[model samples]
Target: MDLNLKDKKALIFGSTGGIGRSIAEALIKEGASVYINGRTIEKCKAIAQEIGAAGFYAGDLTQKGIAANITGQMITDHKGIDILVTNTGGPKKGSFLEVDLEQWESDFQSLWLSVVESLQKALPAMSAQKFGRVLLITSLAAKEPLPGLTTSNGLRAGLAGLVRSISNEYAKDGITLNLILPGYTNTDRLKALNLSEEKVKEMIPAGRLGEPEELADLATFLASPKAGYITGQSIAIDGGVLKGH
Candidate 1:
């Protein structure tokens, strides 16, 4: 299946590791000119070199407005990006009582606003060109709340509203925007959670944690020219873990 991505330029955030890195690898494999992002220049460049990415950008999106600036630079330097995939790091973990107002605000700035700012900068150029693909990599927590993840549960779900509303505005311009909500994937982040695989597998009907490549393949297809008709939608790549309609 040709994704029709031979020369599309893609900028991926949080590409140093985990699911982000998997998506980056998939894009490059499909012949996209990929640029990766990380917080540190040395790590970003090293990953770019190892992965054969076209370049790297350094920015900590937790800080306010940094994503906007990064996208602005991409537009200025490369005349706008054809595909943008932004994956924000998980927010501070806490239960409802454990999280305070300050924590909520912090999550808003880090998880929510960062992606918004990046899209703000890139969407215009895409509209002008009449072509673009935007993929937001969130978590299954966005749909089904997990224990001790109050921030992720609340803020990530908010992104669904953002995608639905904003995607409608740009659909006529040939740009597709969607959310990729992942469940327990086999990544260092999941390993760090120290979850009992036996228990988690009991919950997921698929009987195991997902692989990064599985999620990445879906992302690659969505970002392709062939997926232009799919937009304003939030698709869960969870192993039948999400039961909502």
Candidate 2:
């Protein structure tokens, strides 16, 4: 399980905390050159230092042009990244009727459009090198819609479709695009929902919430050379919560 990830350059967005930070730590342990990204410079730099990342990128992906700007800066600094993990914070939780048009537009921009922009910026370098691993951190809502996550259910599912289409087009170029669906992971986002661990565990067959590192392990593998043949797949790490075929 060498992963053959040594010296590979990786860019992970939303790495200041939670699942993103866990993924960054895993990549660093696998000997990849990791870049920690967050909205604030100080936070990103602190996490980068803590995780021994190669560098850090600061920007808000929700804002216009930010994804392209971050990718451009990475290209200028490291030439280009071999792996790109597009991880973003989830939108506010609410029923479909509770969400407004503005919220939908905002969520679409941050969760969907920004990802497209980042890929557009990073793909050329990946194509030129004939190597790339794109791992998107979506959620179980993408597969089985959650009760209170209307926005995520819609946008993340859309992203899944986009990943499949792009993966087919890029597989010939030595690039693999895939989605990682994390279910009830023990992260800040989960904590913010004020969900009782006992209550949540009761719903999962595993009888426990997933650890961030659990998702990180899979992400590390997906972003490595070993996973070259895997593409356009939405793999869930939801502890049997998603009982769909």
Candidate 3:
């Protein structure tokens, strides 16, 4: 199946490693011109070199104005981007009672506001071209709240709502917006939780943690020209961990 992604320009945030890196690799395999982002210039450039990315940006999206800066630079360098993948590191884990105002503000900026800012910066160009794909790499916590991820659960849920509302407004402009809710993916973030593989497998019907590349494949398809009709939906790649309809 041809994704028709050849030469399509993509800008993916948090692409230096992990699931973000996997998605970048998948897009590259489809012959898309990919731009990766990281917080450090040296690291971002190194990953770009390793993956043969079209370019890379060094910016912290948690900081105000950084998303606009990166997207503005992309527009100048590549004319316009065809695909935008919004991803970032997850917030600190804590129970609702343990979370505070400071943590809430920080997490909101990092996980929620950054995505909104990036989309604002990138949407005009996409609307003008009448073609775009916006894929958000959220987590299953957004739908089925996790035990200790109060910040992520709240912010990601807000983001899911935002995606659904905007997707309706943009579908007519030939742009699709959707979210990917990953569950127990094999990544550094998951490892940091110190979850025993055996224990995690027992919880999942698939009896194993999902591979990053597996999620990447679904993400690439969502960002493809062929998935224009699929939007305003939160699709889970969780090995049946979620039981609700």
Per-candidate TM equals 0.97, 0.98, 0.98
lDDT at position 100, candidate 3: 94
* Residue pairs of candidate 1 with colliding backbone atoms: none
Which is superior by lDDT, 1 or 2? Answer: 2
Instruction: Please give, for residues 35-76, the per-residue lDDT of candidate 2 as tens digits.
Output: 988989999988899889999989998887898889878977
lDDT string, candidate 1, 1-245, tens digits: 98999979899999989999999999999999998998899999899999989888899987898999988898888877899998956776788999999888878877898998999899999999999999999899888898888989988889999999999899999999999999999998887777899999999999988999999999999999999999988899888998854
lDDT, each prediction: 0.90, 0.91, 0.92
User: Any runs in candidate 2 off by more than 4 Å, and if so which?
Assistant: none
RMSD after CA superposition, every candidate: 1.0, 0.9, 0.9
User: Model 2 misses residue 214 by how many Å?
Assistant: 0.7
Candidate 2: the clashing residue pairs are: none
* Model 2, CA-based lDDT: 0.91
Candidate 1 local Cα displacement, residue 112, angstroms: 0.3
Against the hidden true structure, what lDDT does model 3 obtain? 0.92
Cα error, residue 131 of model 1, in Å, equals 0.4
